[model samples]
Target chain A: MALTDFSAEEQIAAVVAGETSSVELVAAHLARVEHDEWNSFLAVDRERALARAKEIDGLATRPPLAGVPIAIKDALSTRDLVTTAGSKMLEGFRPIYTATCVARLEAAGAVIIGKTNMDEFAMGSSTENSAYGPTLNPWDLTRVPGGSSGGSASSVAARQVPWSLGSDTGGSIRQPAALCGIVGMKPTYGAISRYGLIAFASSLDQVGPFARTVRDAALLLSHMVGRDPMDATSLEWTEPIRVPSATRLDGVRVGVIEELMSDGIEPGVRAACQSTIDMVEALGGTVVPIALPHAGYGLATYYLIAPAEASANLARFDGIRYGHRTADADVLLEHYERTRAEGFGPEVKRRIMLGTFALSSGYYDAYYGQAQRVRTLIMRDFAEAFAQVDVVASPTSPSTAFRLGERTADPLSMYLSDICTIPISLAGLPSLSIPCGLSEGLPVGLQLAGPAFSENRLLEVAHALELAIGFDDAPQGVGV
Target chain B: MIDDAITRHVARLARLGLTEDEVVRMQHELSAILEYVDQVQGLELADIVPTTHAIPLSNVLREDVPTPSVSAELALREGPNVTADGFTVPRMG
Candidate 1:
C-alpha cells in the first residue's frame, strides 16, 4: 500500500515494526504538500520535518506518534516556522516560541510537516477572507473547504497529511471538517493550552485536531491536552480517552436537539443526520427529544459576544508591537488607523466595528450585556438537555460545503453556516463532527456534543456512530 | 438604522478607517445585524444572570518565580520599525 494509504496509527506501527522509516513518511507527505492542488498548506517545513524524522529513525523505541506527519493550522505558533494565521498582517512573522499544544506534539514524536491556511485571523465561515486566497474543497474544486480552519481540513481530506491541528473559536474546526468529510474535535474550553496561539476571541477559542477517523482525533487530542502555567485557563490533564476498536452504542442516550433540526437545514443534510440517529437506535441507544430554548438566539449572541471579545483581544495589534505597519502615515493616530485598515480584511474590520459599537458607552447594556445574559440561558439549555441524555446529536452544519464565493456577498448568510455549531462553543462543551454520510454527493457531518470535560464519552459515542455509519468516502484524485 | 456619524465613530473607536461608500454600507449592515440581535430584548431576562465565561474560573494566579521569557531582540524581530532599544512608531501629534 502507498504510504499515504495508511492510517496515522498504522503508520506509527509501520515505523515501529521497521517496515517503513520516519524519513520516508515525512518525505512522502512533504512532496504531496509541495504539489498540493487544494491550496491547503501555507508553509511546508521540509528541512525541520526531515531532520526530525531522521532523529526518530535513529531511536531504538519510538514515541506514540514517532514518525507520523501532522499539519498545523497557521494560527498556532511554531518556533522556527512562520505562523501567519492566514492574514497578511503577520505575513512573515515567525514566533520566538511554539504554542504549548505544538510543543507537546513535537515531544510526542510527531513530525511537523507544514502550516495550513485559514480565514484571516480565524474570522470568516469561508476561507475567502484569507489574504492568501481560499482553499478549494478536495471533493469539489469549486466548493469551499470551510473556515477558518479550511486549509487544515482540506489538507487532511486531500491526504496531504494524515492529521492536522485546527483552532475553533466558533465552529472553525468542526465546520471545516464537516465540509471536508473528516473528523474534527473541539475539546472543552481550557482542555488544551493556548499560550502561543494568537488571540482572536480569547473566551471562545479552543485548539483542536482534525483526522480521518475518530480514533486518530482522540490520539491527537490526548497528546495535546494538559495544564500550563502560561495559560491559566488550561485544564488539568485528564486520562486519555481510549476508543474501543469494536464500538457499541448500548445504553447510550442520544439527545435529538429540536432547535438544531429546525428550518433552514438542507433536506439532504437532514436526511443523512436522521439516518445516523436511526443507526444509533438500531444499536440499542435511546433517542430522547431535547430542547435548547435559547439556541435560536445563538447566532446573534455569538456575533456580539465573540466580536466584543475580539475587539478587546485584537487591540494589541496596533502596528507598533508586531505585524504589518503602514509607511505613509506621519502621525501616531493616522499610523494606527492606516496600519489596521490596510492589514485587516473586510470581515475582520466589520466584526471590530460591530464589537466596538456594541461595547461602546451607551450600547454595552443593550448589545453586549444582552448577549451575555442570553449566553447564560443557552448554557442552561444545555445543562437541562444533558440531564436526560448522555450526548447531543445534530447536523454539524446546516448544509454541506458551499461553492466558493457563494455566501461572501452576504454576511448574514455566511454567519448562518455556523448556526448548528455555535451554541456548543458558547456552552464550553466538547463537541466533534464525524462523517455520517453524503448530502448531494458531498459529506454530511454528524455532530456529537457533551457537557464540559465529557470528551471521553463524546469520543466513544462518536467512534461507535462512525463505525456504524461506515463512511469511507475519500476525495477522489487529491494526493500526489 | 445607524447613522453615518455613529458608524464613523465606531470605526474610529476600532482604529479602522472607512471610505464614504464603506461608511454607508457599514451603517446598513450594522443596522441589520443590530435589528436581528434585538430579538434578545424580547426575552424576559429579569431573572437571568449574565455569563461572562462558560466555565466558571476565579482569579488564576501563578507562582511568582522568574521564568525564561522571550529575549527583547526576539520579541522585536517582527516589528515594522525597530531600533536598538525599542519599536519606532510615527511621531505623536
Candidate 2:
C-alpha cells in the first residue's frame, strides 16, 4: 500500500491489531520520507526514530495513540533530533529536553517520524523563507504548498503521515492547509502547550494539527493538548470529547464575514466559497453576513505585535545560548554582530528590526501600543458577531497557490495573502480549515471559526462539512 | 512615506547595518507597506477590543520540575566552537 494512503487512526489500529509493529510503521514512514526527500523534512533522525519505535513495540498495552507515526514541525524542540526552526541560526542545535507537546505525543505512543521544513522562524507566508530549501507542494511540486506549516500540511496531505503538528501565527497553519487541501486546526490560544515550540511571535503563535481528515486532526490534538506548567498559556484539561461524525449543521448559525469577500478574491475561489455556504444552508445552517469592523486592522495589528514579540523572543539567540555561535569575533559587539549576521536570514532580521523599532521607547505608543488597542477592537468585533452565530465562515485564502517566487519580491502582497485567516487568529478563536472543493484545479479551503474553547464544535462542524462534500484526499494528478 | 530616516532607525534598533543602497530599497518597500496598513486606519473602530491571539487561557502552565538536560557536548554540537563547558564566541566588548 502507498505510504500516503494510511490514516493516523488506521496506522494505530494496525499496530494494535499486530498487523504491523511500531518499528515496521516507523521504518515505513522513514523510508517514505527518504523517497520523497524533496517535498518534506528539513532533517531525518532515522536512528533516533527507529530506536523509539522499537521501544514502543516492546510495550504490552499501547496508549490511545500508540505506535501512530507522526511528524513534528521544525519549530518544535526534540531532545533526540535537531530543532532548527528551518533557520541556519540553529542549524545543529539540539534541545536538552523534548517540548511538552512532543513529550505528550510520545507518551501516547506516537512515533516521531522526522521534523518537517518551514518558513524560517515561522515568519513567511511561503516555505521559501526557509534557510533550508523550500518544501514543494506534494500535489504539484511546482507551486507552493502554502506556508510556515506548508511542509507539515503537504506531508500529511500526501499521506506521508496520518497527521502532522504545525504552528499557526497569522495563517501559517490554516493557509497552508487550505492551499494543500487538508484539514488544519488552530485551536484556541493555549489549547496546547507551547513549552517546547520555539517562540516566534509569542503572543500570536499557537501549535495546531494538520490531517487528512477532521477527526484525525481532532484525535492528534486531543493527545497533545492540556495545560502544561511550562506553558502558562496552554488549555486546562477537560474530558476528551469525541466529535461524532453524525454532526449536522442544522440550526447552527454561521456568520459569513462581509469583509472577507471583496473584488480581489479570485473567481474560482469565490465560487468554491459560495458552494460551501450553499452546502451549509442546504444542511439547515443559517448564513448571515456579519461585519467584523475591526478585521480590517488585523493585518496591521499582527505586523506590529508579532514583530515586537519576535524581537524579544529572538534576542536569546546571541551565539552564547542554545543555538549557533561564531568564533571569529574579536570583541563582544563583534561576536554578537557576526553571529546574528551569519546566523539569521534576511526575513528574520527584517522582522526583528521592525519589531525593535515598534517597541522602542519613543515609538512604542505609536506602534505596539496602538496595535494592541486595535487588537482589542478586533477581538470585540468577534465577540459581538458570535453573539448572533455559533461560528463564522470564510475562504481560507483569497486565491489558489501561486507559482514559486511569484510574490517574493513584494512583501506586502505576501502579507495580504493571509488576510481572511488572520482575523480569526487575532481574536484567539478556535478555527478549522478543511478542503471545501477545488478551484481551477487547485484546492481551496473553507474556514469554520468558533469562539474560544469551541474546538469540539469546530471539529463537529468540520466533520459535518466533510460528510456533506464527502471530500477525500486527492493529491495525485493535481497541477500547479 | 517611509524614507531613509525610518530605515536607518529601524536598522539600528534591529542591529543590522544595511548599506545605503539597501536602505533606499527598503524605504520604498516599507512605504508601500505602511500605505497598505493605512487602509485599517479608515475603519471607525471606536469600541472594539484589539484581538491578540486566537486562543484564550488563564493559566496553562507546567509543573516546576527541573529535569536533567542533555550533555553540554550535545547541546553545543551545532555551535561553531565550544570550550570550558561553554560555547566560545567572539569577545562582546
Candidate 3:
C-alpha cells in the first residue's frame, strides 16, 4: 500500500520505526495535492513542509504527528501561509500570527501541507462562495464537496492528506465531511481556543478536524484542544482524547432528533441513517425518538444571529487594514463602501446588509433580539434532549452531494442544506459526522451529538458505531 | 418585506457600495431572507432570557501583566498603507 493511503497513526509509526522518513510522507502527499483535481488546496508551502519534515526526521523525540502531512482550512490563520478565508477581501493578506489550533499542530510536529479553500469568511453552505472557485467532490467531480470546509474535507477524502483541520460554524465541517465521506468534528464551544482563528460569528465558530477514520479524528483533535491565554473564550479539556477500546454500544441511548430527520431529507439519506440506527439497536444500544420543536426554526434564527455577528466582526476589512483596498475612493466613507463592495462577493454583501437591517433601529428587537431568545429555546430543547439520551443521531446533511451550481442561484435553497446541522451549532455542542453507509452510490453521514464537554463519550459512541458499520470511505473514480 | 429604502439604508449602514443592479439584487435577496426570518418575529420571546452565547460564563479576564506582543512592524506588515510603525489612511474632511 502507498504510504499516502496509510492511516495517520500508521504513518506516524512508519516514521518512528525508521521504515520511512517524514520527507517521503510529505512529498507523497504534496504530489497528490498538486494534482488539484478537486481544487481543494488554496496555498501550499512546499519548501517549508520539506524542511519541517527534515527537522522531524532529525528529532531525538518524536512529536505525536511528527512528519505527518495535514491540511488546514483557510479560516484558521497560518502565519507562514496566506490565510484568506476564501474571500477576495483578504486576497493577499498574511496574518501576523498563527492560530492557536495551527500553532498546536505545528508544535506537535505535523507538516502543514497548505490552507484548504472555504466559503468566503465561512458564510456559505458550499465552497462556491470562495472567490477562487468551488471545490468539486472527490466522489463525483461534478458534485460539490460541501463548504465552507469543503476543501479540508475533500483533501482528506481524496487522500491528498490523511487528515486536516476545518472550522465549523454552521455545518462547515460536518456537512462537508458527510458529503465527502469522512469523519468531521466540531467540539464544544470554548473547548478549543479561537486565539488566531479568523472570526466569523464569535459565539458559534469553533475549530475542529477532518479525517478518514473516527480514531484519526480523535487523535488529530486531541492535540488541538486546550485553553489559550490568547483567547478569552478558550477552555481546558481532558487531554489526549481517547476513544474507548470496547467496540460495543451496550446500554447506550441514541436519540434521533425528529426535526432534522424529516422534511427535505432525501429518502436515501433517511434510509441510511435508519439502518445505522438499526445497527445501534443491534449493538445493544436503545433508540428513542427525541423531539426538538425549536429546531425547525434553526435556519431562520441562524441567518439573523450569525450574520448579525458577522456584520460586526467583518467590519475590520476596511481598505486601510490588511485586506483588499479600493483605489477608486478618496474619502473614508467612499473608501469603506467601495473597498468592501469590490472585495467581498455577493453572499457576504447580502449577509452584511441583512445583519445591518436586523440590528438597525425598529428592527433589532424583532430580528436579532428575537433570534437570541429563540436561540435560548433551541439550547433548552437540546438540553432537555440530552437529559434523556446519551447522544443524538441524525443525517449530517439533508442529502448527499448536490451537483455544483444546483442551488447556487437560490441562496435559500443553499441555506436549506444546513437545516439538520444548524440547531446543533445553535446549542453549541460537541458533534461529529462519520460516514455511516452509502446511499445511491454516494456516502451518507450519521451525525452524533452530545452535550457540552461530552467529546470523550461522543467519540466512544461514534467509534463503536463506525466499527459496526465498517463503511469504506475511499473515493471512487479518483486516484491519488 | 423590506423595501429598497431599507435595503439602501442598511447597505449604507454596513458601508457597502452597491451598483444599481446590485442594489436591486440585494433588495430582492434581502427581502426574501427577511421574509423567511420573519418566522421568528411572531414568537413570544419577550418572556425568555436571551442567550448571547452558547456557553455561560461571567468575565473572561486574564491576569493583568505586561508581556511580549506583536511588533509594530509585524502588525503593519499587511497594511494597505503603512509607515515605519503605523498605518496611513486618507485625511479626514
The parts of candidate 2 lying over 4 Å away from their true place are A1-3, A477-480, B40-79, B87-89
Q: Once model 1 is optimally superposed onto the true structure by TM-score, how far is the C-alpha of residue A409 displaced, in angstroms?
A: 0.5
Candidate 1 residue B29 C-alpha distance from true site, Å? 1.6
Query: How does candidate 3 score on lDDT?
Result: 0.90
lDDT of 3 by residue, A1-480 (tens): 688788898898888889998999999999999988899999988999999999988989988887899999999888858988999999878888899888888999889989999999998877999999999899998899998899999999999999999999899999999999999999999988998888999989999999988888998888888889888888867555784564888889999988777867999999999898998878889999999989999999999999999999999999886989888566788888889999999999988888888899999988899999999999999989988999999999999999999999999999998998899999999999999989888989999999999899899999999899998888876543
How do all the candidates rank in terms of DockQ, highest first?
Answer: 3, 1, 2
Error of 1 at A203 (Å): 1.1
Off by over 4 Å in 3: A238-240
Q: Distance from true position, residue B50, model 3, in Å?
A: 0.3
Residues A202-246 of candidate 2 have per-residue lDDT tens digits of: 877899989988888998888877877777777676867464485
Interface RMSD of 2: 2.9
Q: Which portions of model 1 show Cα errors greater than 4 Å?
A: A244-246
Worst 10 residues of 3 chain A by lDDT: A237-246
Q: Give the C-alpha lDDT of model 2.
A: 0.81
Among all windows of 10 consecutive residues in model 3 chain B, the one with the lowest summed lDDT is B84-93
The lDDT values for all models are: 0.90, 0.81, 0.90
Clashes of each: 0, 26, 0
